[model samples]
Target: MHIGKAIRLERIFDRNTKRAIIVPMDHGVSVGPIDGIVNMKEAVGKVVEGGANAVVEHKGLVRCGHRAEGKDIGLIVHLSASTSLSPFPNAKCLVASVEDAIRLGADAVSIHVNLGDETERRMLHDMGKVASDAANWGMPLLAMVYARGPKVKSEFDPETVAHCARVGTELGADVVKVPYTGDKASFEHVCDSCCIPVVIAGGPKLDSTEAFLRMVHDSLEAGGAGLSVGRNVFQHENPTRLVQSLNMIVHEDASVAEALAHLNG
Candidate 1:
């Protein structure tokens, strides 16, 4: 691996703790102007202040200077795009190149792949090509895999999510971001089968902070590296407060109750 790629991976991989707190700001490309990220600077600041290890964002977000805005955190740029407004929302397009990501001073780059759809073959081809280019540059690759084909079970299915993880690693994703199955016993099969570090995605925000914390706790118990959460922290009335509580659970090993206590602390 190139020195640039190695250093980038180390920054987010958290070898010391074997975990990370990543805030994914790439949602704008997929869902368009969602909560919290409307004011990108404030959102980025909230996570950085709360001790997030990295922020995953699209080229537009990166160009907004969130990384420089939060000097301490690593920036992983997403090279894919598939907007809700598109005719085919599942057909991810390669919008940014690895070269552009490197030029923009990104620490790493990410790709999105959704399996079991008519668009599956195109996405896999794009991912494999992007990964090959990224590897040539020695850039670390983060794969956001979702099982969304005609045959996909519910998004929460453990078996489907496990396949997502396995396929991503087999195709060369350095880190795989996936949904957390409610039970550790089921998700363990996911973590155990994939060789690369696995991170859990915070899906649509839950109604209660406690619910969010419970998911985070369960993911860690299942051997997840950390989280790539969006609305749960950013959409909250107090992003700083929410991130503070989440940071306790992610990096400090605080239980859900203890972390919730820090919400107001």
Candidate 2:
């Protein structure tokens, strides 16, 4: 790893634990101002207060949520965008650049790619370009890789998830985010195949905090680096508490029950 990349990664990952609790706030570009994040600054404060390592968002929203006081969190500029209203929502396009992210004071930059989309070829091309630019700039790139296509029978299939993670690593991503394969045995296979750090996506919001924490615990047991969870953390009744629980599991090696206890206590 480049010295510059390592320095930047230190801002995102716990130095002692080598894990991260990242809150992805870039969903507005895809789903629009949903609850829990309509007030970006407040939501960001909650994340920081809970000891989250980083938060990911588009370039425009960076200043909106950045704090002038308090412990700072890592800022990752998301480079892709595709609205839910679009007929081809899976067709993510490069809406920003590594240079743009640098100008925005980003610690890292991220891109999204759906491997099985009809526009997969185009997205892959864009991802390569971004990876190249990121390399030139000595910036870390987080790839949100998913197996979403007409032919895909199950998005959470271990083999499919492994393919998605490897695609990110092959394209030069420093970190890859993919759906959890539902079990530790299967998920461990996905982690083993990827050279870069692999983080699990939050997917849809879950019914309970304990349930969400258990998923995080299971993923960590499968050898995942950490989490890039979004809705599940931000939409919880107490976003700060939820992030605290996540931090416990991801960085402190806390069990699911212990994390849930911290949330409830």
Candidate 3:
């Protein structure tokens, strides 16, 4: 890795722990203004106050969320976008470039790719171009890879998720994010298949906080770098508390019970 890339990566991943608690606030592009992130500034503030390492958002919203004061957090500019209203919503398009993210003072850039989607080929082509540009500019790239196509029988299948992880690494992402394989053993295989840091994506919001915490715990046990969770963190009744709980789990290696206690207490 280039020194510049490493330095920028340190902003998002803890230097000592080498892990991250990233809250994605970029969902507004895909799903419209969701509940937690309707007020971008407030949502960003809540996560930063609770010790999130970074927040992922699209280029347009950077100014809305950027803070000159208060606890500092890394900014990751998401380059790809797709609207939920689209007939093929899984087909993501690159709306920003590495140069654009740098101009926005981003610590990193991210792209989303649906591996089995009908538009997967185009997405992969764009990803390759982004990876090349990121490398040239010495910017770290995080790939949010998913298997959400017609042929995908199970998005969380260990083998399928492992392929997703590898696709990111093979395409030159610094960190890869994929859905967890539902257990430590299966998830471990997903982690082991990728050379770069593997982070688990928090899918939909779960019914219980304990289940969420437990999933984080299990993913970490299976050698995940951390989490790129959004809805579960930002939509919670206490967003800060939830992020703090995740921080404990990802950075301090706290037990699920202990992390839950921190959230509740």
Candidate 4:
């Protein structure tokens, strides 16, 4: 790996654990300014305070969230977007570049690609180009890969998730994020097949905090590198506490019960 890329990746992934607890705040572009991220700086601060390794946001929002004080957190500039208001919401298009991320002082860059979509081909093309540019610049790339189209019955299907992860790895992503397949065994298979670091995505908010923590714990047990959860963390009643719990589970190897104790304490 390029020395620069390796150094940048360490900012995102904990050096000791080789895992990450990433909070994606790029939803403002996809779903408008939702709860938990209306004030980007505050949202970023909460996660940083809770010891999150990184936070992902779009290029435009970088100014809104950049911190001049407090503990430093890795910044990952998201390079692709598709608004929910659009008819083809699944079709993500490149809205920024690796160079844009670099200019913004981002520690890494990320792109989203929805496989099985009608415009999957175009998204793949864009990802390929961005991957090349990122390599040339020695910028770490995180690929958010998902299976969301007519043919896909369930995005969380283990095989489909594995395929999504493999797609990210094949296209040169240093880290790949995919929806967790429901159980440890299935998700283990997904992680085993991908060579690069595989992180789970926090899908729609779950029923309870325990359920959310359980999912993260299970994924890590299944060989997952960590997570790139959004709503579940930022939208939680206590975003800081939630992220603290996540850090314990992801980096400290704390059990779900122990992490829950920390969260509630």
Candidate 5:
């Protein structure tokens, strides 16, 4: 690993572990107040206390209050934008620059690119440029890759997810955030191909805790580094305990029940 990449990784992980838990709070840009994100600062505090290594957010969130919100956790500045109302919502554009993130003392940077979309090539082009900038500045890049297009899988098949991860790795991402393919047995292909550290994203808040924990455990069981869940953690009734339980699963390798015991917020 490059000295710079190693230094940036330290900012995002606990000194003793390779696995990490990061909460993404960049929702304000797309879905305003869907759920569990009513208070960004408060939500981040709960997760931080529970031992998340870092939090990924848009520039506005960081500018508004992430510093005081996440003083103890790493901050990854997200520079991409896409909205729910847009007909071509998958076409994300770069709204912020690496220089801006560096000035804000970001530990890393993240961007989202939907592979196979009509505008896929354009998005990848932007990602390449952003990745180059991050490399030149010695900052780590986290790529959120999702396969979406005319032939993309409806629920994200293992193969498609693996392909997405591979694309991110080939494009210079230090870490690739992807969606889980239901189970450890199924998603292992993604981890195996990317080689780069993988983190699963929480797509939407689940209806049950069992479903949530199962997904987290399955990801790690397969070979993932950790999770970048936001709504699932912040929106839970007991944010503190929910996050703590996630920490137990991700960091301590605890079973679902053992982890759940610590989650009665």
Candidate 6:
């Protein structure tokens, strides 16, 4: 591994735990400014105060979330985008470059690839190109891979999730994020098959906080590196407390009960 890549990854993944609690705030490009993230600096501060390892955002919004005084948090510049209003929303296109992330002082860069989409080939090509550029620049790359298309019955299907993870690894991502496959056993298989660190995506907001915490705990127990969740963490009633509870599970190895207790306390 390049020393630069390793050093940058430390910003995103805890050095002691080799895991991460990443909050993706890049949704502004995909779905417009939603709750919790409209004030980028405040949202970033809350999660950072809760000990989140990193926050992902698009290049332009970097200025909005930049902190002048506070505990530092890693910045991951998202390189691909497709708005929800687009006719082919699943088709993610490269909107930024590895060089752009470097210029923005990002610790890492990320791209999204939706397998089984009509523009899967183009996304894959973009990913491949970005991976090469990132490697050349020694910038850590996080691939957000998912199976979302007509043929896919359930995106949560373990097999499909594993395939998405594997694709990320084969394409040279240092870390890969995918939807959790519902249970520890199934998700364990997904993690086992990928050589690179695998993290779980938060997906849609769950009905309850305990349910969300339980999912995080289960994925960690399954050998997942940790989570790159968005809405669940940022949109929670208490974003700071929520991420602190998550930190306990991801870094302190707390059980669901213990983490939930921390959340409530």
lDDT of 1 by residue, 1-265 (tens): 5787778888886777778888888888778888788877777887778777888888777756454544578889899888888878988879999998888888889999989878999999999998899899899999999988678768779888999999899998889999998888998899999988899998888898888899888888889988888777778888777877877887788899998888867
**Which pairs clash inside model 4?**
none
Tell me the spans in candidate 5 whose CA falls farther than 4 Å from its real position: 67-71
Among the numbered candidates, top lDDT falls to 6
**Candidate 1 at residue 28, lDDT?**
82
TM-score of each: 0.95, 0.99, 0.99, 0.99, 0.95, 0.99
lDDT of 3 by residue, 133-188 (tens): 99999999999999999899999999999999999999999999999899999999
Per-residue lDDT tens digits for candidate 5, residues 1-265, read 6788789888886667688888888888887866666677777777877777888888877856463533588989998999998998888999999888888889999999999899999999999999999999889999999988887856378888888899999999999999998878878888999778899989978899878988999899999999888888888888777878988898889998888666653
Q: Please tell me which model should have the higher lDDT, number 3 or number 6.
A: 6
Q: What CA root-mean-square deviation does each model show from the true structure?
A: 1.6, 0.7, 0.7, 0.7, 1.6, 0.6
Query: What is the per-residue lDDT of model 2 for residues 1-265, given as tens digits with 9 covering 90 to 100?
Result: 8899999999998889888999999999899999989999999999999999999999999989987999899999999999999999999999999999999899999999998999999999999999999999889999999989999999999999999999999999999999999999999999999878899999999987777788889999999999999999888889898888888889889888888888899
What TM-score does model 3 achieve against the real structure? 0.99
Residue 235, model 2, lDDT: 88
Please report the TM-score between candidate 5 and the true structure: 0.95
lDDT of 4: 0.94
Residue pair clashes in candidate 2: none
Count of clashes in candidate 1: 1
